[model samples]
Every structure is written in structure tokens, then in C-alpha cells.
Target: MTALGELQRLRASRGGPPRKRENKAAFLFLLPWFAGLLLITAGPIAVSLVLGFTDYNLIQPPEFNGLDNFNRMLSDERLHSALRVTFTYVLVSVPLQLACALGLALLLDRGLRGLSFYRSAFYLPSLLGSSVAIAVLWQQIFGAEGMVNQVLGLIGVQGRGWISDPSTALSTLIVLNVWTFGAPMVIFLAGLRQIPVMYYEAAAVDGANRWTQFRKITVPLLSPIIFFNLVLQVIHAFQSFTQAFVVSGGSGGPSDSTLFYTLYLYQRGFNNFDMGYASALAWLLLVIIAGFTAVNFWAAKRWVFYDD
Candidate 1:
């Protein structure tokens, strides 16, 4: 029976038409992703784009008002203030974060004792940075009678509320942004380790000092990694939310100094019940970030280098 079945199967295989090489496995794997892309991402994006031109506040039916939202945003005082604060935060925080990250990475890359322990310790903050608990901790640390003021009291230097004083509130958030540089520090460390020892040795043989080697070889080779970190950090800084959200008590107060763009969108959509305006704001932010990323890539041609 087995022999007869095998003979029949062989005959069937020989007589059958050539099978189509369908990519069933690849199609199956992509099915769930495609569904998610359509439902979660693409669907909402389309809805938001439509809402950007309407006057829907989630309670009333949407009424088409082409260009009105954009024009209103142009004349909006609160949006301008939010934009100023957001830009200030991005400009100050991103570069300082990258600089601090690079510095720490260089320090850690020097074959320190218990390097793993130090690495984990440094990375702990990045993990906790977005947590409400950490934001609350930051609030306490920068509050009127918080630890910073206590330290200041010991030194007899008058201390205002770090999170309440408009002048210091934004700067405190910038410091918070810089303090979470550990993730970038780890990336920089990995990039540093990828540098071949031969390059340094060859430079040394030619009488190149450490600074000279770093300038000529280390920096140039690491330029790609630096550029990657810079772009990522800038985007993250621009979209910062939790720290300011918690510190400002969800009101973006202290005279709106910490009113980040995202926070403002939340204020409009949720608090003020203006979903259409918030959607428009969100689209504008998306465009701003896209423009910034595009400009960075354009400028990167001059500064960012690739190894041959």
C-alpha cells in the first residue's frame, strides 16, 4: 500500500502543473502589521488631517472651515507663547544633552572599574525619566521648599521656587532634559569602542597627541553616530511632556513658561474641549518636526561624515 501510494504521489507530482511560488510566509507575517498600520496609524492620521480643517470639538458635529484653523493658529497668542517656550527648550536642551552624554561616554569608555555597574547606574535615570514618580520627584527637588532650596538655605543664598519661577522653571526642565542623557551616553560609548586601536597607534607613531588624534580621526569617524544622536535628541526634546506636565501640575503654569507644544495640545483637546484646534496644533507640530529633520539632513551633508 505504501509503495503504491508513493508511486501514485510521484506520478501526481510529475504530471501536475508547476506550482506558483507564493510568498505565503511573508504575507502571513505582514498581515497583523498591515492591519495595525491601517487601523491604528493610518486611520487616525487621515482623521486628524480631515479634522485639521474642521470645527469639531468632539461634542458637536464637525463643520468644514478651510484655512480658518491655520489662520487662527497664526494669530493665536497662546500658540505663539507655546512655540517660544517649546523652541527655547529644544534649542537649549538638545545640544547640552548631547554634549553631556558624549562627555560621560568618554569618561566611561576609559576602562573604568565596575564599568557595567556604572553603566547601569547612569542608565537608570533614562528608564525612570518619563515615569510620573520621577516627575513628582523632580517637582519636589525643584519646588519652593524642596531639596534645592534646602541646599541653598544652607549656603544662605536665597532660592525661589525652581518650578514656580518662570525664569528658572524652563531652565530646570532643560536641566532635566540634559540629565537623562544616559541613553545617548551608552550609544556614544558603543560608537567610541568601535574605533580601531590601529588608528590611534598610527597617529601616535606620527607624533600626534591625544587631542590631535581625537580631532583628526576620532571625531571624524564618530560624526555619523553624533549626527544620529543629535537628530534623535532634538526630536525627543521637542516632544517632551511628562516632566513639564508633572512639574507644572498639568496646567503648564509658572506663567506658561513650561507650556510645551504637546502640553498645549493636551490643554486644548482635553481641558478646553477644543479637539479640532488641538488636532490642527498637532498637525502643525508634526510639520515643524518634519521640517527640522529635513533641514538637519540637508545640513548634515556639510558636517556629518561617512567612512569610505
Candidate 2:
């Protein structure tokens, strides 16, 4: 046969050009998410990176300032204070929040009465945690004449304006952050439920106490879930803006005690119209979060037990 005829015969024997129907279906399904990533996410990130090296206010065109913004941070006392506040908040709130969540999840895992109601009630705070209304409510709750002081008054323990005192203002915010433990609680409950009951039974037959089993089996198995929540909460805490902003009344006030990193960035960007500096701050935050996350993943190898 001629070469062309042989190729045609081979094609006929096998199949036509691959249609890639599955790939096309997957691409179709993923189109919206891909579009969002490019436009809403990646686009802004790229623009912000470029803007970080340039001086730009909303009223003027950007002028390249090289590393001025980053350099300015070296001498910025406010930036240091903001970083201190942010790190303190994250370090304190995340572990406490996770602890509260795990404790409540354990309590709920005991097959208690009205379990659904308890779960819903506990989770309600997380739903409203980031809302302006919640922050406003928090301000009232901790205000001198607010509910907290009112209770204190009955107990004859005088209270000051919790949100207005630099010393106590940050603590109130920390308390607020800790109160929103519901989301992680749910995750813990799910992880707890996933543990095979037989493991507990086996441990019991081996005369292992509750603490022993919990330390050995529960902690090891649940380490993965704990790691996941840790990473997410750390990132969330770093990016927190609304609570501090609303509570501080957009001032990061009471002696800058509530000046979270994101709040400082917002003040710089919009309030001061220092978009370039704000972009730099944003980039710094991105680096910090990425570094922490990388460390967490690295550290996970030592502790997080995966069944894989």
C-alpha cells in the first residue's frame, strides 16, 4: 500500500483525533472560578505589587519612588506599634480560640441533649464576628455605661470605658476574637466524629485512661485538623480589619492600642491617601502570612500525623 493509504488504514483501525471531552467538560466547569482568579484576585495582587514601588495618591499619577515606602517603614514607630498589636492579637487569640473551640466540641461530642441547638447557638457568634454591627455591639457591651459595666456595678466593681482605654481596649478586642470560636469548634466536632469508636474501646480494654488515649490517639489523629484550623485562623487574624476599625471608630485609637496591621494599612491607604505606603504594608503582611504558613507546613512534618 502507499504511505498515505497505510496511514489511513492505521487511523481507521485505531480511532480519530482525541476529542478530550472530559478535559473540555472540566474547563467549562472551572471557567467561572478561573475568571474570578484572574480578574478579582491575581489582577489586584499584580497591580498592588507594582504600586508598592511607586508613590501614588488618588489625586495624582504614580511616581516611581523605588524602595521609599519599604524604607520609610524602617523608621515608622506607628508601624512597629501596629505590628506589635497585630502579633499580640494573633498569638493570643488563635490558640485561645482553638482551645475554646476544641473544648466546646468535646462537650458537644458527648451526645448531649439539644445538641443541634447548642451547636447552632455556639456558632452564631462566628457568623456575626466580622460584621460592623457586631463591632458596634461590642463597643456598647464594653462601654462604661454598657452591659459589662452594668453587671460590674451590681457586683460593686467599677468599670471604665473598655473600648476607650488603651490598656483594656485591646483586651476587649481579644475577648471578642476569642468569642468567635464557633467555626473551629465545628471543625473539631467533625474531626472528633471521624475517630473510630473502636479505637477508644481498644484503649479502654488496654486500661488506658481518658487522658492517655486522648494524648496518644486523639491528639495524633486530630493533629491534621488542628493544623488546618491553625493556618486558617492565623491568616484570618492577620487580615482582621473590620473589628478593630469599627471598634476604634476608624481611629485605631485610645493611644493607638487597637492599631492592627490591616487597620494601619487602611488608615495609610484611604485616610492618609498614601496608597504606595499602604501597598508596601500590604505586601509586608502577605510575606508575613506566607512565611508563617510555610513554617507551619514545615513544622507539621514533626507533629502532624497523616495516615497516607
lDDT by residue (tens digit), candidate 2, 48-113: 999999999988899999999989999999999999999999999999999999989988986789
Model 1 residue 246 CA deviation (Å) reads 1.1
Over 1-308, each residue of candidate 1 has an lDDT whose tens digit, in order, gives: 22323543475575568777668987898999989988999888888989999998777899999999999998998899899999999988899989988888888886789889989988888888888998899899888999999999999998988888888899988888888989998989988988998999999999999899989998998887888888788888888999889999998888899999999999999998787888899899989998988888778879877664
Q: Which residue runs does candidate 2 get wrong by more than 4 Å?
A: 1-28
Candidate 2, position 136, lDDT: 93
Task: Give the clashing pairs for model 2.
Answer: none
- Deviation of model 2 at 115, angstroms: 1.2
What lDDT does each candidate get?
0.87, 0.90
What's the TM-score of each model vs. the native?
A: 0.91, 0.90
Q: Give Cα distance to truth, residue 161, candidate 1, Å.
A: 1.1
